[model samples]
Target: MAAKRLREAEESGEPGRRAGGGLLPFGLVDVDGPSMVPTLYHGDRVVVRYGARVRPGAVLLVRHPMRQDLLVVKRATELRSKGWWLLSDNQFLGNDSRDFGPVPPELVLGRVLARVRPSVSWLAPAGRLERLLCGWPLGRVPGLAARFGLSRRLSPLR
Candidate 1:
């Protein structure tokens, strides 16, 4: 079967990634805002691990208390008295902990390990790429959610 071959390739440690395999030994997350800007983007893919240590500059995905279903990614700024005070890399962006207040460490799902950007070796110039590198907003999560649809929609049938 196709899956059998993919599993074999993974076991072989081939440079060619197998289907459903990741570049790192962690879950891959899609960046959703300009919070991490040049370091991360709206569409860039990032790897994260559940037990990764939290650091000042590390970007993280955390659950919103009021809306537990909604997950937001932001830079870990300071460990404030209340909780972790997260901030967006783009100072102009206002939809972060600075607006919502400190977030509990329990809310954090994982820490970003690395980022992967879209390759454009054979394509034309992209202004978005420039903005991404300049610490400005360039990617979003809505498009990713729409492209993949809700988790419920993607669930396999019995």
Candidate 2:
């Protein structure tokens, strides 16, 4: 049924679905870019709890500060006076707090609860281990430095 709903939403050309006018508290959004690669890929479907409690390390669906029409998925890396200091799992890619500065609280739409498309992954607030995994070269062809004989975590600073 959710798949059907997504398909209908796609046909209608909407970015995602906001559950029936307060009838439901969740919404569906598609992961649209490489900013969150490895952890989330393009076309991945996610379930977000609208107005859910926000926490550092939680993944959230946020409205772009400068471009309101764009919705972005990012990790709430820090809480500043303005709002969340968001960052991408793939630091090498995507626009994040480094680009737009802290996002206002109201622009945060929800916390991502799980991924439902392509696969099912409960998106609990990530911790150091999870963040470590995001930078680790695992289960990926490009991640393997087997040829070079010295594969290291993608990020040396971490």
Candidate 3:
């Protein structure tokens, strides 16, 4: 339902954006790290629908549970007894549930709908192929991957 509302606002080209004082159904957030590599890269701008439905495999914008001042983009990998178990697609570089345990649903700010930077297009949400590719040996590269445009994960967002 929340996703539908956001799509409606996007289709209507609504002007009541949260940035404009009136709250739109969705907002834009810039991706800042490689935690969601392949699916989301540094500098990518994403459409986030607040209160959108979060299910396993949804890309999410969340407040870092241990550092509320920090916002991180992660994927909902499982629903635990306590809360959502989040994971980073970039297995080699994650600071996720493995490190912080399950995250309270309250920290989930929104669901990522699409990538609007470098290009404007809807995402193939829950892309298993992309997720699989992220864990390849290349994913461990803190030095190599981003330098060669390993995937759409490292490209011009400007």
Identify the leading candidate in terms of TM-score: 2
In model 2, the worst 10-residue window by lDDT is 149-158
lDDT of 3: 0.65
Q: For residues 1-158, could you state the per-residue lDDT of candidate 3 as single tens digits?
A: 01223333435655655421237657777777677777777878878877788876667777788887567778777787878888777768758888888889887878777788888755434445445445677556564433322233321111
Worst 10-residue lDDT window for candidate 1 reads 149-158
- Index of the highest-lDDT prediction: 2
Per-candidate TM-score against the hidden true structure: 0.56, 0.67, 0.65
lDDT tens digits, residue span 75-133, model 1: 67667677777766566767677578878888776665455455211111133442343
Give Cα distance to truth, residue 125, candidate 3, Å.
4.8
- Residue 84, candidate 1: C-alpha displacement in angstroms: 0.7
By TM-score, rank the candidates, best first: 2, 3, 1
Candidate 3's TM-score: 0.65
Please give the clash total of every predicted structure, in order: 3, 0, 0
Model 2: lDDT of residue 146:
23
Cα-based lDDT for every prediction: 0.52, 0.66, 0.65
